[model samples]
Target: MKNINNIFLYSALFLSFSVFAQQGKQKKADTLFNKFSFVKASKVYQELIQNNYNKDYATRKIADCYALLRDPRNANRYYKSVVKQENVPVEYYYKYAQSLRGMKKYKESEIWLQRYIDSGGAPGNNDFTKNVNFISSVFGAKQQYFLDKVRFNSKFSDFGAFEHDGKVYFASSRDEGVSTKRLYGWNAQPFLDIYVAKAGTRKNVDHTAKVPGEINSIYHDGPVTITKDGKTMYFSRNNFTKGFEIKDNKGLTNMKIYRAHLVDGSWTNIEDLPINGDDFSTQHAALNSDDSKLYFTSDRPGTYGGSDIWVANINEDGSITDVENMGNLVNTQSAEGFPFINAEGVLFFSSDGHIGLGLMDIFATIKGDDNAIVDIINLGIPINSSTDDFAFTMNPNGVTGYFASNRRGGRGSDDIYAFHREPVLHVEGVVTNAINMTPIEHTKITLYDENDKEIAFMHTDENGYYQINIDRNKDYKIVASQNKYIEDYRKFTSKNLQTELITIPTNLLLNPVHDVAKLAELKDIYFDYDSHEIREDAAKELLKIIYLMLYDYPDMVIKIESHTDSRGSLSYNDKLSIDRANATYNYLIRGGIDPSRITAHEGFGSRQLTNGCESDTDCEEADHQLNRRTHFTVVQME
Candidate 1:
């Protein structure tokens, strides 16, 4: 009796163990399929189907895997099968919706998108936002202006978009990106890819996903963008490729950027991006809003971390210039990449090093007047998250932008999404002369992008003030030049400085060399405020005059005069102006102008207005400004 009882117990234990083993194998198969390792995972799922086990999870995962592997036909087929099974979770609906979109079944895809949203699935991750706007953009060349809101949102993550002719053309890998296959693993799903959609409008959910095919290849493929002329396509790809794959000394794979020129209306030949074959990885390319410059990301040497964004010029020959490090201010110790240059010179990039809500977040930086690159500002919370978020592409129009994020949930490893918003650029400043407090009249200023190409030129009015109208997504070099002065310069890096940023001071203190030489015209001697003091400005002018005297004649001497406008009494004005002239004499003495050979002090109160110019009573302020002036002839130079 004891032996028979033991046998019955053993039989029961064996049955339980068998069931558990079958479930483990089934779960493992589901995981493999979700990881984008479809080739092997498919075999497991097929076994489950043959063995007649619970195939719902396995079925859904297989469909998602096919989509990630860029095999739309199979993915679409399986996704349909999951829906037919009925009572599918909202996530399953989302995957099926994407699968249909991949097949260009816009109507069906949009229906599923609606269903998913209606089923308590929120927006903000990969498929986080509405799809109406993206759908409309797919049929045209312009879309970026509509996607800015999604890109600029403080908490949303977006990327993988394309832009053209003032339009945004890109994608976002956000919401629901944390699938079982990507996070915390060795064999993670390399699931980013190329997708095209319109910006700003109510994007159709059916417009959200596509077949990918040659466009999305393996791993990741976009924020796909074309030059304004629409002659070339620029985009980013991840750790692996379809054909060319190389290993470094460390045995690690790096991302590479590629470009294809639109020849006769079709992208004819694709080539690797120049400067992208460095030891590190590189991706994402954005041309300046004006089409004069190009920006991108790379983990090349000199970067702050995993991948700091770098920029280079798109030369007239269509080649890139040597890469310039954006520096500590814009890049942090973590990964910082994906830079977008707006027309107004404010640059946007992604970084994980600086303070941010995620592993990587977007940042902005402003350029200075000296043509120097400044640090980047980590775009805070609204657009960031505790997850990995990056890849931003922008256009000046109020339409679109591309960004990426890995948030709560999504179909594949990371699916690309789309959207739109307004564009922005900022610039402001003040202008003054180099030697004196006096305002410079009609100071001409020219603005150039980082590539040294001219963007704007203006003249300072009587107030000696000028301001630049900055277009977002542009870089500029403000070159201030006048007929008698050396060039004064200001640099707007386009990353940090924006609207109402500190008023850029237009103080033109160009070297006095040009105006002080023998052949050079001596504009005038200048003095400090109210005190008639021979200030540093005065000294700078005197040095120039002294040098001219020495060069023209080894020994020369002269007198200096101080004049005042008709604002004071005769005795007081006369004595005051004399002392002012004497101050000039003392300044020259200290400036190596031999005192023995020079004499100073003499004031003609309100007496000197140039001939032919109107009198102070009837003339423009020019006459009075000239009246209250300082003058000095060639003093002794021994």
Candidate 2:
């Protein structure tokens, strides 16, 4: 019995020791994760899961690690384990949805995304849920860009291409041949440095070399923009500069934008920008066309997300002021950074917050007439992928450019890729009435391809103007229609088109149905003296209207008005005119016209005389005969 008790005691001691050891390991893994060391933390979390110690928490952490590392395949695998577990946080559902999207499982991603939304996961001001068909629309769009990986890419991260003076400048994590190699803990990669090479489209040439300057440090650096004169430079670097490092309260070093001057063909005079903060990151500097404004990414106080695009006015003395956020239209509740402003002032940036195919997708800003950002358009496919795609830089020609992506088949974790943009085709015109030449507002415009398949549709603006993007070298049909008007169908071909934009010179004209109904020339039906019955001549005139309403315009509606000559007392004439109008209404109904088509049948009682036929006045008998008649007027036509 004593031996059995001893065995129990030994077992308990061993169990207690194991629990303490596991707790210690969990604490260590959490510390590493907090420090942004996802690669190391992931391994530790996997070990904890193998020991079955706090398996749920460890599983979630492992998934989070893979997600931060942009490894959606592994993240999806691990997230599947805990997403269905009891009491799991709702955010895991959102993360799992993102991972599925990274794998191009868009339908499955939508299901999990719906579940996340149903579970009360707040997505802020983004309209992902509102636009349920956005994914389909994105995939349905034409391919805009063709990409080719640059040959200089190493087996490490090589991205952020910027062009100046016929040379391509970029950032890379390749070995620098320093005696003591320093590495970033996030992905176990070497510190980033600036490199330069001759700018060309050739795939076999590799003339990459480090920038000839003291710009590099033991920490992260590079990804730069130079002024039009090639005298001033702005770049991103770790907070460590001037032989010291600045860290936030969490002991994490943030990024900062620095300025440098080019002297005698070498970059020097390095200085950090005043907009940077020790507690937050401010990097990825870009300049507008005129160099009067500087654009950059920052996570300072007023940001709507992890980071947001910010603009500052450039002073005459190479300083910045009047910093402003780009607003919610360009930023969301997730990360947005790497802004690149083109010559036309179009803002291109990368975001994980907006609706995208996966982790980080590139987007372009659509500005209003006031130059405020009104909307954002996804750059869709080839330019973006299921992984991080950012640091887009466009050349002056606008057709050819470079961007970076960590997508599949890359030579490294991230690679710089040259891209050629295909020319886009657009058809624009105004819709107007054929008879009166008046602009027809709210006309429905539909576009159909050669296969007669409806491709897109929209309503014309208040000014009767419409514009639609079409595919090059394809036959298309545009149909414009409005209420009470005949539809106008115009077929055109974009085949062999050389220009990007074409304005249809001829306005789309819709003929009003009322104009066509006028062919009936509805003559008045006269009545004999003191008679409220229809004559043969009256029946002949009524048949014209009946035939048109039944065979020509079945949806037409009309009203009947009857008048009497001034021969009897006012009350008698009024009663007689009403009976005449009612007779006409009944005749039309009996002739197979829908009763609802007759909007009204009323008597004027000699109030609307066609001539001076009052009882006190001497007028011709023909004028009196004209007064005793029933008239038809079209009220509505569909």
Candidate 3:
């Protein structure tokens, strides 16, 4: 899952073997391997394997070499041969899994993942166990994105997409000139260089041009970050100056962050960051939303892992201070880098340590109210793969974003992909009382899908309002409940609309069963023609009465009053309306409303008509329908 930054290929340490008696050729191969010359080391190791001398160790070493070179084909072949051996390290299983993933063998990769876990890899990390299940769930989830290759991608590695000031800036290894053609040993690709292109539709994107000569160095210089105003810029480059490279204790030159100021429509006054160090790398710089803290990936001392995300405070004078590791919440024993924080404070980064679908899956971390990382969620499929998927950036809206990956179907090595998240509908509303329309605070609300399956739950705030996200083209049943009030229910649907935001004006008005007149305020329940059964629409309204009597005031008594129109004969109307009232009483009892609470069932035969139509059609159909209705009143409180 390592980003193939060829300029600093020495950062990847070669695997060591136990010293033993060997021939001259084997000794020379070990020498090359120790010097971190994986390309030469692999050749010698292969020769030993061909001769059946030190076959086991040589096979392992060659596999490691191919892996270091990012050659998945050879790595997979060699790993498959020896990975099943009992003496093989647990890491071999992981490497084999990554290799399979690189080849788009997802199911086979999953088998190796199980082997890695069974071999005690990352013991006691429950997140690793959950990650296996999370990957499966991700594949079955509704597709949330539509991906397309970015137009500016080159045949070489092109990634790290960022937008600022009407231009898109990214890192590319595309050839510029013969002078800038130094090759990186890892993938044998030219060193990365920052390129700026007009940011627009594919048809209008200007051919990408290299940045000013001051920014483009012979070594790696790319993956830039800009302030909100697009004035200040920070980019990654090898720690070299004046035609000489800075080497650490391991004889490896590390990457460093550099600052550049925008002046007169060009980047000028370029300088190295104050935090640069020779012992470790500090690259992939990013600024928080308010520019208060600068976030970057570093392999410095005191790191909890190979590479950790560190943050430094940006003071008023623009000097950085108080650099601290983001801690284990974001870092692990494995490499984690390419940190990007959006305006919403959600941190997105790539990691191999966290259990993921593949090698380096992108993860999102959101902090809780206490500023602790509440959840570290893997951004699953299409955004992540078994291959290296890092260097993610997005616009303010978050509907569209870009990330780089070496997964299959790419235009070339590590192609940059543009993706847009499908719109997720938001449901927002206020919970208020029906009588005085007063805000109901702290009301528990549960959201369920059409099949009555619960989706999510929340409590109404002090302002009597709540909001939650729901999927589009789905029907939801929202149930609002409070201890002292009658519960309310609403049926809502997203209806296949792809709008950015959708608000449902659901106001739950609960009538207290203690007040008889207030209970009567509920709309009259109507029955079908010549039938006493509660229709579907009328049953929904009846749920309020049932909830009030059963939940709010279990012992409170209520009377069911069924009225009949003036059309039927007096005796028949009386008998029919009585049966109708009894039917409603039975429905409530079946719904778990206490039958004891229903104190009375009475039918009035055409006696309480407001239209005053006696045995004649003097009133319109609307008036007659109103006369044939059911009403409930509280007969007792407490």
Worst 10 residues of 1 by lDDT: 135-144
* TM-scores, each model vs. reference: 0.38, 0.47, 0.49
- The residue pairs that clash in candidate 2, if any, are none
lDDT of 3 by residue, 1-638 (tens): 11222212222111001111234466566544433345677888988787665466678778766655546788889989978654565767777776777677878978887887887765333232343432223222235567865777767888898887778888888774555368988899888889888775474222247776478787898899999887888999999776788989998889999988888878878887788898999999988888888899998998887899999998989888999998887899999999988766777899999888788888776454344555466777779887999998876655567889999888779988888676434576667655434466799999999999987898886556666767677889999998657889999888855333334556677755465455543567987656688899888887766645544455678789998888878898888799889888888777766667788888886678757767755777777777788888777877
- Please, what are the lDDT tens digits per residue for candidate 2 over residues 16-94? 4665576568767765554334566788999988987657778988887666555679889998998977767687787
Model 1, span 339-362: residue lDDT tens:
776644567777767766567776
User: Relative to the unseen true structure, what is the C-alpha lDDT of residue 83 in candidate 3, on a scale of 0 to 100?
Assistant: 87
Q: lDDT (0-100) at residue 57 of candidate 3?
A: 63
Angstrom error at residue 547, model 3:
34
Q: Score each candidate by Cα lDDT.
A: 0.56, 0.78, 0.73
Query: Against the hidden true structure, what lDDT does model 1 obtain?
Result: 0.56
C-alpha positional error of residue 391 in candidate 3 after TM-score superposition, expressed in Å? 1.0
**Which candidate wins on TM-score?**
3
